[model samples]
Target: MTTTTTTSDHADDPHLIGPFAIVPKQDCTHLADHDYTLPASAKRVDGHQPPCTDCDAIRENWVCLEQNCSQVGCSRYQQKHMLAHHQNTGHNICLSLSDHSVYCYGCESYIDSPKLVQLNRQLVEASN
Candidate 1:
């Protein structure tokens, strides 16, 4: 029996987060018929998911200017403009795009991807 998997198949799968999924990479063709199960340890934990630590720090240090918004905005709506307004008011919950690290003055949550870091820098600068 042959089974084919695609990104869409894992779109709603709890084990799938961000861009990674169980589908075979374009270069690999041998495992097309098998269902791959990610290890339990790889599954994300409830509430223990990755934290935007920088955002948390920012909230701790600064108060939001928008009456209805927090550092990341409301649970129902998140707007960058609102977040920028908060930052402009001295909330420092910005993350480094180059590495997905949060900059909390001298304290940082380092996310090692250079591309993400660069992207984050661009976003912060643009917002400013």
Candidate 2:
């Protein structure tokens, strides 16, 4: 399993507190109709820490939440490939493969969803 460490730069942001980013709200317009379901084609091709599609860094990777897109990319703190994916495809939501934390680039914040958490839990369990 991959581990996440909080950096000093994130200390100033109240919403990014703790070992992980804080979920300010539970509602996200982009996920308002989302079912938090992974596509049938989705699989951990590279185990828990998949290499970013745009780069070799895998420590801070994330998977796109868009149903048809299973693209993985390093986090903004690394290569920003996931952000680039969002910019290029307008697919704003992603789940951190490191911690299964849901984030919406459109909302620019962490999002809370029990269903999503459960789904990620299942994914993790299956992988083990």
Candidate 3:
């Protein structure tokens, strides 16, 4: 009696697997070795901004040091409470100069004096 063994018998054969089949397994190792550095387009450092004291309690969009409402229509304008409200409402507080003084009307806080001039300058330059 003769028995026939078909290719299906060796279907699990490692040698039969093509390069494409093995490519995905290598991806993890490649990713492990990868530096994952920021892109060149991200080379420019962000300009200095005041730190949020209540960042732990705030969300990303609403983060601000000023306690004023960053929202345009909202009546609440107190700096500390506004920061909390802004965090809750997902509003971005404006941080810019007004009447030759650096202030964020939205957050209702003054920026650091050292950075205030530079920030105003940047705004002025951008407007031109």
Compose the digit string of candidate 2's lDDT tens values, residues 69-105. Answer: 8798899899899999999999988888777778899
User: What does each candidate score in C-alpha RMSD?
Assistant: 18.0, 6.6, 22.4
Where in model 3 is the C-alpha error above 4 Å?
Answer: 1-112
Which run of 10 residues does model 2 get worst, by summed lDDT? Answer: 39-48
TM-score winner between candidates 1 and 3: 3
Task: Estimate the TM-score for candidate 2.
Answer: 0.72
Model 1 lDDT per residue over 1-128, tens place? 99987677777764455566322123222222322222122112352322222443222122221223333322113224424544466443333222223333212221223323444454356447
* lDDT of candidate 3 over 21-108, digit per residue (tens): 2211211211222222221211112432222333321221222222332222212332354345555665433332112223344433
Sorting all predicted structures by TM-score, with the top scorer first, yields 2, 3, 1
lDDT of each: 0.32, 0.76, 0.33
TM-score quality measure for candidate 3: 0.23
State which candidate has the highest lDDT: 2
User: TM-score for each prediction?
Assistant: 0.18, 0.72, 0.23
| Error of model 3, residue 70, in angstroms | 12
Top TM-score prediction, candidate number: 2
Give model 1 RMSD, 1 decimal: 18.0
